[model samples]
Target chain A: MILSILAMAFREIRRHKMRSALTTLGIVIGVGSVVALVTVGEASSAKVRADMAAMGNNLLQVFPGSARRGPVRTLARPFQEEDALAIRREVGSLALVAPLATHSGVAVAGNSNHFTNVWGTTEDYVEARGFRIGRGRVFRDSEQGVAVCVLGNTVRDKLFGDRDPIGESVRIGSLSCQVIGTLQAKGANAWGSDQDDFILMPLRTVQRRLKGSRDVNSILVSVSRESAIPRVKSQIESLMRERRKIRPGQEADFFVHDMKEVAEAMQEVTGTMTALLGTIAAVSLLVGGIGIMNIMLVSVTERTREIGIRMAIGATAGEVLLQFLMEAVVLSLLGGLGGVLFGLAASLGMSAALGLPPVFVPWIIGVAFVFAAAVGVFFGFFPARKAAMLHPIEALRHE
Target chain B: MTPLISLRKVCRVYGAGETAVWALRDVDLEIDEGDFVAIMGPSGSGKSTCMNILGCLDTPTSGTYRFRGIDVGSLDRTQRALLRRHAIGFVFQGFQLLGRTTALENVELPLIYQRVPKRERRRRAMEMLDAVGLAGREHHTPAELSGGQQQRVAIARALVTRPSLLLADEPTGNLDSARKFEILDLLLRMNRERGVTVVMVTHEPEMGEQAARRIVFRDGRVESDERLRPLEARTA
Candidate 1:
């Protein structure tokens, strides 16, 4: 019985092809936009996570001042190399520590000049900051305060085209330094900053030969294990407070930042954005359901005589209800299927055009299809009931 | 044998209070098996109301109606529908065949409601279409068929379920004189050959003359009842 009713519904829908297609348009657009937006958002979040991971895993940075609270008011003097050495010796959860000082300058080699950032750090900077030596070796410990430098991939490409830069000499400011190594290629960071555009030299060399100062700007720390991050962070905070002479109930002169916090914040923002877009698209689906209800009511009124004929031919009210309800469900299901195809195509187009990774989420597709069928049932009820409750005699008498 | 239908003081009232209109008032009726009865009256004389009650499509406001020893007035809506589904068939004046459906599908509607298997349903529907002289026109929709052919399809649908009682309200009202007699002859043949009890409401005296029994209604009451010679015998 249900099969016959479904067949009748299919025939009826096929009879008025244009109206049925028009009614399903809203649902198609709704599901399509929902899928596209969620897929793009997920891909973007994954990109952020990858970028963060590339920066450094389980890494933290300690800055000298609480700059976020107000203007850069210096309550404590800048860090020295001794602070990094003390943290490495005292903290049990510490893996590696590097004190860093940075300055921007122009480097000249063989009549070629390029403006690049230069960093002063120890040998531990390579491991703590997740850098690799692509060509030559890192400077020896005994080579501190000597005129030795390492070039980043971008700096190497800019200053020395395709030639080998190892054992060569470059002029930094008024000082000449010998290049000892070249770092591997590390792409852009999460904030779109180029990470491989800087040069690294020994801390004592930058202090004595370049800056003529012993102040370090920041200190980088890597934890031994991911589960020990919180304990290590608290230890660094208290150690810094004691070393900077910060008493109880007083705000410390420094702050610690974990890379995981930034990743989590970015993930949260993307999740909220996806949900907002999904809600707006869901509203369109509701509007589509309303369109179905309107057309179904009109159909019931137009087919009153047919309803009378069926009733007289021994169709129960429940049977008539099921027939009309099935029609609405079939209509919405078709729309949903079309929407899924459109959504996948749109997502693929976006990924290709925007250079984003494609993300296919199975649950989103399942949810959208199920919701479309539910919309049919919820909105189609009133019209089907109206068709069922019609009086056979009065309906037959209707002109 | 038990009567096929019995009614006692059946009254059908519409509206309320000062605007109350009695469509049927204090009416009593009985019909036996294998009887072809014609209900004849002018417009607004309650003939259609009587037909509706007999077909189990409507219930009286004040009285008892029994069909095959079952109390129709006391039955719920679903039970009444079940009774109608199994034992009653109806044909209408407008040849109320579904517009877009084929002749075979229209005939198969009752069997579909009965949950008959697909193959059996097709065979039974095809047989009924062939019996109605529409063998080659089974696949033709109502729009593609002539008026007489559409009426024939409606009659085929009515008799497809092998119903014990057939109620037709002006089955030939929309047809020309030639098509009218053709449909009337078809109904007469069903009654005489198959022993099916038929109660038909018609406005024409000639159509009334074709029945084995004639009943006339006036002002919501029966005015005359007569048993006439079978039209088949008279014509012979």
Candidate 2:
């Protein structure tokens, strides 16, 4: 019986193809936009996480200042090389720690000079920040005072133009530094800034030659496991507070920034935006449901004689209701299927065009499909009841 | 033997109080098995209301209706529908064949509502269409068929369930004189050969004269009833 009723619904819909298509347009656009927005949003979040991983896996940084106290900023004393050593010694689950000092200068190599950033750190900087030695090896840990450097991909390209600069000597400010290696290319950071545009050297090299001070600007620390980052971060924070002579419950003179938190915050932001767009799209779906209801009502009115004929031929009110309800459900379901296909194509195209990794969440698709069918049920009920409640005599008499 | 249908002092009223319009007033009727009865009256004379009550499409406001010795007035809407589904068939003056549906599909509608299996329903619908002399036109839709052919399809649909009673409302009102007699002859043949009880409402006196018994209505009351021939005369 259900099969015949379904077949009857298909026949009726096919009879008025243009009207059926127009009726379902609302549902199609509603489900389509929701699916596309969610898919693209997930892809963007995943891309941000990937960029965070590229920055460094489970990496944290300690800067020499509290974030804010009563909206009045205060600058604290800089960290020292001993602070990095202290974190490495005291913090459990510690992977590596590198005290970083930075200086900007023009390096001249055989008349090809390039203004570049120079990062002064230990050999552990390569592992702590997820950089790989592209050509030559990193400097030894014992070579703290040695005037040796590793050129970043961009700096090497500017100075040597694809030529090997492993054993080349470059003049930096007033010192002649030999390039011992070149780091691999890392495209960009999360903020769309060039990441492979700096030169790396020993911490003492920049501190003595450029700054002429023993001040360390920042300390980079990597945790062995992602689950251990919070524990290690707290340990390093307390240790820094103690080292800087800050009492308990007092505003510390240092801040520990965890990269994992940054990644999670990025995900949360994208998720919120996706939900916002999905809700707006769902409103359109409700409007589309109204469209279906309106058309179903019109259909019931127009087919009054047909309904009367069926009633006279022994169809019960329940059977009549089921027939019309099935029609509405089938219409919305078809629209949902079309929307799914349209959304997949739209998301895939948008992700490809925007250079985001395409991500399709299966559960969202299932939910959208079910929600569309539910819309049909909710909106189709009144019209079906109207059809079923019709009087056979009056309906047959309808011209 | 108990009559196949009985209506005892039935009254069907519309609206209420001073505006009340009595469609059927103090009407009493009975129809035995295999009888061909024609109910004739002018518009507003309540012949249609009588047909509706007989078909179980409407119930009287005040009196009792029985079918096969079961009290129909006590039955609910669903039970009335069940009674109609299992025992009665209807043919309308407008034919009422669903537009855009094939003749075969229109004939199979009652069987579909009866939850008949697909193959058997199709076979039975085909046999009924063949019985109605529309065997080769099964796939033609109502719009594609002529007035006579559409009426034939409607009749095939009405009888596909092989119901015990067939109620037709102005079954020939829309046809030409030539087609009119053709349809009248078909109804008479079903009554005589298959012993199916047929109650029809018609306006034309010539049409009413062919029935074994003719009942005339005026102002919601039975005015005249005459038996034109014996029941065994048509069969013999």
Candidate 3:
């Protein structure tokens, strides 16, 4: 009996080839969209994780914009040089604390002139960021205005080739600096910006010779343990607040940048992207569902006499309903199974093309397949009922 | 033989407008077990309505209906369906097999409604398909079968449940002369060999001559019921 019903379902779907194809197109679209969106989101999250781990996983940032700003995005107050030194001196949970002075300038290295971002800091900056000098030693504290420079990996490759750029010289603004070190290559972060295209200098050299600014753009504070990050971040926030002399409820200019915090924002944005992508893709599935409904409706109309014949042969209303409902689910499920395969292949191809990691997100797979069955239930119910409620005598008389 | 079906003042009214017509009015008909009967009528006669009530597909407006000594008029929809599944088999004029379904599957439908198990249902359906002389054509869908083969398939479907009562609502209405003879031969064989009670509604006078008894209906009442002599028995 079960085989008979299944056979009937198969026959019905087969009879309407064009309609079946059109309906399957819906499932394909819905499942394809969901797969691609989720895979892309997974790839992005993976990228964020790699960045956080590379940028000293246990690091925390203290800024003036946070402690007094609640959860809002605003510049709180400037974190002075005194606060960073004080945190480094006072905090026992810290591994290292580095103050950053950043500015952008045009630099000329052997006729290769480009506008590049420059970061000046102490030796602790390299340790706190888990970066190695890749070629030469970092600058000495007393080498202020000594015109020594360290080239970023991209800058080094673009400026000097195989001739060893370690001894090369570059002009930054009015000051010409000799190459002291070359940075190791690091890839781009979750953001599309290049991570290895910046130039690093000593704090005093940048303060005195480059931008001539005493204010720091940001501070990097590294903790010795991951479990101690929150405690360390809160401690640094209060310390900065005390030193910056900011009143309660008043905004500060500085902010603490934490990996988890950045990840949360990244997750929200990725989530939105996933939904938008899935929603757009899911329209196809909904269309596929409607197609199933439409086909079932047509089948009901065509099989009026058949329904009447069955009723006369002792079929109850529930039995008739069950038969058609089973048929609809079977049809949609077959299409859904085919769609899963199609989506898998499409996502693999897309992932390779986009150069992102390929992930088969289980939640999406479950949602697509089960949701297709649900769609069968959702759309199939009405038509199935109509077929079941038919008066057997009337149906038999249909000409 | 006990009355296998009894209708007390059965009335089936069609349409609700000013042109409302009574298909069956105050019908009280009875058929004994293993009877071969034909309801003969013109196009507008009430024979079809009697067939519908007998098949349990229609309920009387103000009458009592009994099948196998059970009061069917009081039964709920579910109970009535159960009664139809086990007690009645229907053959239709147009041979209304579900399109694109194999002959075997179409024959298996009534058994499915009976909740027959998979293996048993298939076995019975195949057996009936073969019994109707469509032995090798079980896999062929209705569209792929000829008109005669399709009618045979409908007959097999009607008889699969081994129901005591078989109702054929103009069973050969759409068949060619040859196909109509083949169906009539199959129906007569079932009546004579298996002793299955058969009630047929047909407008053909020649077809009416084949049954053991002919009931002629006109308007909303029975015009005459004549005991027709079986061709072979009476001639022999």
Candidate 4:
């Protein structure tokens, strides 16, 4: 019984080459888009995880409040510089502490002015975050209170071109600081902003000389151990409350920014995007299923007399149904296999051609194949049953 | 003599309520094994319905239909289907072969339903096609074959199961004289060579003369039935 059905399916495909190719095309497109989208999404998530680890392997962020409902430490109400120093002194789990300050304006070097943000950190900044110097030397500890600077690769390229920028001067607002080093390029972030286009200066240089005195935007704290992070954050929060003399039930004005927490948030956002794309892909699969049902119905109609002849020749209705159903499933399965092959090739092509990494997942591939087959079964049954239940005598008599 | 097919007071009423129409009424007949039988009548004379019942494609609404002492009237749809597949081989007036399938594939179809093994199925199907004088034409599809050859493929399909009863409906109704004779001769050879019981319906008296027995039907009932004398016996 199984053998006959399989033979019939093979014959049907051979006989209707164009129609079968067209029908299988629907499945190929459906599964192809789904698999490609999923693989790309997985690759992206993995890349984000690697970047987040590189940025801060042992960092923990503490927010003043939960996400969404609260304003993230208003610009006018800045976190105090003393809060960072206190977190460092009170928390024994700390490695190096730095109060982060950002000031965005036009930076002028060699008569070429480019709009960029200047991040202010002290000498300990190099070890606090994993900042590697691509060329020249990092600023000395003596330069913390002086006007010295390190340019990210893009800033160095845009301002100094191929010429050496080390020991040269660049102006941020009214202050002129000497460039000491060029940091390695870190590419872009999830927000589509370049991470390597910034200029870094000594904490006091920006606080006192450029932006004018003592106000810090956020605290960048590096924990010595992953396990001690939560405790260290809580200790900083409590010490801040004590130092600021804030009473019970009053909110603190300061917030901590950690790369891991930001990465988690970014993952959630992208995960939702993947789900949205997945839903669109699923709709296409449903469309493919409907395409199978539609084609099977047409086949049933075209083969009505043939069905009758088989019954007249002694085939049971079940046997007839089995034949058509098997044909449908075989069509989908072939299409699914073709789709997987095409999808993998497309992913690799996209990676090579566009320089976007594509990932491969076995479980997803298996699931897509099964899903396509299931679609065939679900949609093929009705039309096949219709063909089977046809009255043999009447069918035989069909013109 | 064992009766190959017996229908006692068989009636087939179609539709329901006021629309109910009787196709066959009070039909009683018995065909012996190895007999070539023809039920002849005009269109709407219930001859086709009788053929359907005899072929196990339809059941009599009322009365008894028994094949070799088995009450087909009591059998359900599946059992009747099994009987069709295993006990009877059917040929059609239209030469109802699947359009895309080759003659070999068409012949192997019924055997496939019979759950025959692949190698054996193809071997037997080709043998049957060869017996029908369609030896090299096994790979030709229905569209590629002539009317007579298509009918021959249908015949091969029917005989592949090695069924005892051969049921044919208007076997030559659509063919030219030459094609018609070719089909008739094949059926004759099958009946005489294999002792296969043959049941057919024909519009032409010349077609009826080929059979061993003649049953004339009109108004959904048997008008006359007679055991036919063979031409050789008459000449002798």
Candidate number achieving the greatest TM-score relative to the actual structure: 2
How does candidate 4 score on lDDT?
Answer: 0.83
- Specify the highest-DockQ model's number: 2
Model 3, A114-169: lDDT tens digits are: 78888887878877887777899888768755668788888887777665888889
DockQ of candidates 1 onward, in order?
0.78, 0.83, 0.63, 0.74
**In model 4, which residue pairs have backbone atoms overlapping below 3 Å?**
A314-B85
lDDT of 1: 0.88
lDDT of 3 by residue, B1-236 (tens): 44898888888887877988888888888887777899998888888778877877778877888898898788888888898888788888888888767898889888877778889999999989889999999999999998889989988998999988989989999988887888898999988776788999988888999998899998888888887865232111
Where does candidate 2 stray beyond 4 Å?
A66-74, B233-236
TM-scores for all predictions = 0.95, 0.96, 0.87, 0.88
For each candidate, the alpha-carbon lDDT, in order, equals 0.88, 0.90, 0.81, 0.83
What RMSD does model 2 have?
Answer: 2.0
Ordered from best to worst lDDT, the candidate numbers read: 2, 1, 4, 3
Candidate 1 residue lDDT tens string, A1-399: 778899988999999999999988887888788778877887788788888877877898988775323665545568988888888988888888988988879999998999998898888888877888899988867888989999999999999989999999999999899999999988887677899998889888888889999988889999989899999999999998888878888887788988889898988888898899888888999999999999999999999999888888888899999999999988888888888888889988987786677889888789778978998898888899999999988888877
Docking quality band of candidate 3, CAPRI definitions: medium
Q: Which residue runs does candidate 1 get wrong by more than 4 Å? A: A67-72, B230-236
C-alpha lDDT (0 to 100) for residue B79 of candidate 1: 79
Q: Which CAPRI category fits model 1?
A: medium
Tens-digit lDDT track of model 4 for B140-213: 98999999999999888888888989999999999999889889999988888877889999989999987888
Better of 3 and 4 by lDDT: 4
Position A144, candidate 3: lDDT: 54
